[model samples]
Target: MLCSDLVAHYGLKKSRRVSIQESLGIFLLYLAYGCGNRLVQEFFNHYGEIIHRHFHKVLDVVVNLSKDIIKPNANFNETIPEHILNNPRYYPYFKDCIGAIDRTHVKAYVPQRYQIKYIGRKNYVTQNIMVACDFNMCFTFAWAGWEGSAHDTKIFNEARRRREVKCPLPADGKFYLVDAEYPNKKGYLAPYRGSNIRYHIPDFRRGQTRAVREPKGFKK
Candidate 1:
C-alpha cells in the first residue's frame, strides 16, 4: 500500500532507462545496509553515472513520502491495554501507564563546519531521535532530526512546543512512562530518584533465581 502511494505520488513509470522495481531495489539496498554510492553501484553492476542519478531520484521520493510513512498510530487514545492491566508486575501500580518514551542515537553525516555540533559525548556524529511505544511494543510516536549533542530534555521540550510528534494527551488520570531524564509532568510519569533504587524490571530480575522459576499461581 505504501509503495503504491509513493509510486503514484512521484508519477513513476517503467521505462528502458530504469524500471520502478530496480529503482526501489536500489533505494532499499542503500538504506538497509547504509552502503556507499560506489558499493551500491558495484552490487547492481551499473556504471557510476547511471547508479548515481537513479539513487538520488529514489532518495528524493522516499524523503518526500516520509510524512505519510512515519506517523503516529491513529488508534492511540492514551489508555492502558488489558494485557498490561492484567499483568501482576505492572497492574495496580502502573494501571494508568499507557506507554514508554525514550531517545536513541543514530549515526549521521554532516558537514565539517557543523560536525562539532552533531558530535556526541561518545565522540561520534549522530542524530538523537525520540520514540514513544505502546504496551504492544509498537511505536506510537517518533521525532527525529535532533542534533546528537542535544539533551533528551531539550528534544522533548522542542517536540512538545512544536507538536512535531503527536503524543496523545493523557486524560482521566492516564500518563505515559518516561525515564529519569524527563520531568515528572502532568502527561509523563517518572520513577523516584536516588542511589540503590531499582525501579526497572530488569533491575529486579537480574541475578535472581525467582525470575527463572514458574510462578506458584501458574495455571494451565
Candidate 2:
C-alpha cells in the first residue's frame, strides 16, 4: 500500500525498489501510534529492528505523499472563529473582522549568528511568530521564525504586501481591527489616538462617559 501510493505520487527511483508491504507497514505503524522514531523502534522490536534513520525515511515518504492526498482545489477553505462571527459587540469597530493578529516567540537550539540583532529588549533570545487567528481562536495562518528584533507592525505590513488574507469587503467601505502598534490606514481601523479618547480607555463604556454621556434618563 505504501510503496504503490508513494511510487504513483513521487515516482520511485529506477534503481532502488522497496516492497509495498514493507513501506505500508512502517507508515501504518507511525500513523497508528503517532510516536517518535525511538518509541516506534522499541514497540516493534519483537517484529524487527528499526533504527531512527530508517524511521525518518518512512516519515519522508509520508510527507511526500501529502501532496497527492490534499489535491489542488479552486477555493481555499478558511476557518474563522465563532465569536468573531457571532458577537459583533466585542469588535464593534471592525464589524467584519474575522481574525486577530499577534506575534509570539519560540526558543531555538542553534540560533543564527549575528543573533544579537534578533534578541529583544527583554534580553531573552527567540524567534518571532506572527499569527492570524479566526474569531473561534483557531489559527488560520502562521508566520514564524522571524528575528525577534523585528517589529510586529512591520511584519503585518509585509503580510499585507504579500496579500496573504484576501477577504472580500463591503461595497461602502472596509476596515481592519488592530492594536496601537499598527498605524491606521484606509482599510485599517486602530484605537483612538491619545489618552483623551475615552472610548478605548480602561473602565470606559461605549457611547457613555463624562464627555459623551446622554442627559439624565434620556432615551436614544
Candidate 3:
C-alpha cells in the first residue's frame, strides 16, 4: 500500500506510541472528516501535538510524491494512447490529442490580510489548482498554490514557465483539450466561444422559467 511505500522511501518512521498506520490514519481522518486535532485525539487516544506533528509529517511526504506520481507518462512521446486508437469516434481526429486540462478551487484558510485574494466566484476562500490528466483518469500534470481569484489562463501561463513542473508539453502536433477559459493555442484545443450556444444542458435551462402566478414583466 501507499503507507508502506512512504515508510520505505519517504523517511516516515513508526512512533513509540503508535505505528505508521495509526499515525497516517489520524491524518487521513482529520482531512476526510474536516475535524480538528481534538477530535482525532479523542478517537486515537493521542496528544494534540502528536496528532498535529504526524499530520505534517505525512503531508510533507505526500507533497513530495507529486514530483514522481503526478507527471506525464514515460512513453507519452513515442506512442499514441490506446483509448484514442481503438475508439472510432476519436481515432482519426483526436489521434494527436494527449489529454484534458482544467482547474478547480480547493478550500483554503489563509491569514486575514490575504483572504481577499482567496475569495473565488463561489464566494468562498480557496486555492485554484490546475491539472491535466490522461484518458485513463491518471493525472499527468498538476499545478497548484494559486489564489482562488486567479484566472485559469493566468495560472496555466505561469505554471508552464516553472521548470520543475513544466512537463507534459505537447510534442510536435499533439494537443490537450481545454475549456473555453483557456486559449486555443498551438498545443491546446478549445471550443468556439458563442454566447447563444450553451455548453451544458443545464445552462440552457437556467433562468428560462418562472412561477406561473408571477407578473409577466417581473424582473428578479
Candidate 4:
C-alpha cells in the first residue's frame, strides 16, 4: 500500500518562506518548462529573487551529492575486469576496451534574452551533456553546459581539451567504446562506418536469417 500523505516527513527542512515540496516543485518546474525565474515566479506566486534563491538552494544540494554519486570506481585503475576476461567473445577482442562515451540532451532553463542560443535540432531548449562510464555502469566523468545546438563531436573535442573538466583520456593502449556519431580515433573506438556494416542490434536479433553476401560488421 502506498502512503497517500502529502505532508509526510521529509529529510529536508522547509525554508521559512517555502515548504520542501514547494521548493522542489519550483526547481523542477523551472527545468521542465525551460523558463526564466521571472516566469516561474508567476506560477509559484513568489518574487523572482525568492524563486531564484530557492532554485539554487536546491541545486546546491544536488551538486554536493554528485561529488560522490558521479565519480569513477575506487579501483578504477585495476586490471581488466574478470567478467570481461572470462567471456570468450569479449576477452581478447575487447581486452583494451575500457569504457563507453556518449552524449545526451537535457532540458535547460535560461533567461529569455539568451534563449535563442539554446535551441537545438530537437526544436527545443536543451543542454548537450557529454558523459563516460565504465562497464559496471558507473559514471566516470561528465562535461555539460554546452548549448543544445552544439554537435556531439564539438562537445567531445571541447571536453577533452578543457583541463578543468578533467575528462579522462584512455591510457596508452586502452580505448573507450563510442557510438558511430563520434569520431573513431586512437582512444575512442567508434563502430566501423559504411552502409555495409551491420552494427545496429536489430540487425542481429535472434531468428533473423543472415544472407551469405550481406555486409558484416562487429558481429560478423
Candidate 4 — which pairs collide? none
How many steric clashes does model 3 contain?
Answer: 0
lDDT by candidate, in order shown: 0.74, 0.55, 0.82, 0.75
Measured with C-alpha atoms, the lDDT of residue 126 in candidate 1 is: 94
What TM-score should be assigned to candidate 4?
0.67
lDDT of 1 by residue, 1-220 (tens): 6557767886555557777888777888887998888898788887778777787778777755654555545645554587777899877888777788988899998888988988887689999988887877877677777889999999888777874355455666878888777777887987655334655577677842222223346554
Model 2 over residues 43-109: C-alpha lDDT tens digits? 5452334444445566666655553443212222332235644666665544545445566777643
Q: Summarize candidate 4's per-residue lDDT along 1-220 as a digit string, tens digits.
A: 0111222422245678897778888878977888887789888899988898888877766554454467666555556866678899899888888789988888887889877788888788999888998877778887778899888898888877877567777778888899766878998998755445556577677535333332344453
Total clashing residue pairs per candidate?
Answer: 0, 2, 0, 0
Residue 107, candidate 1: C-alpha displacement in angstroms? 2.2
Better of 1 and 2 by lDDT: 1
Better of 1 and 4 by lDDT: 4
Q: How accurate is candidate 3 locally (lDDT)?
A: 0.82
Where model 1 places Cα greater than 4 Å from the true spot, the runs are 9-17, 44-57, 60-73, 164-167, 199-220
lDDT of residue 198 for candidate 2? 56
Candidate 2 pairs with clashing backbones: 81-135, 81-136
Off by more than 4 A, model 4 = 1-48, 64-68, 202-220
Query: Against the hidden true structure, what lDDT does model 1 obtain?
Result: 0.74
Predicted candidate 3 versus true structure: per-residue lDDT over 116-190, tens digit per residue: 999989799999999999989899988778899998888888777777766578888888999667877898998
Most accurate candidate by TM-score: 3
How far in Å is the alpha carbon of 156 misplaced in model 4?
A: 1.1
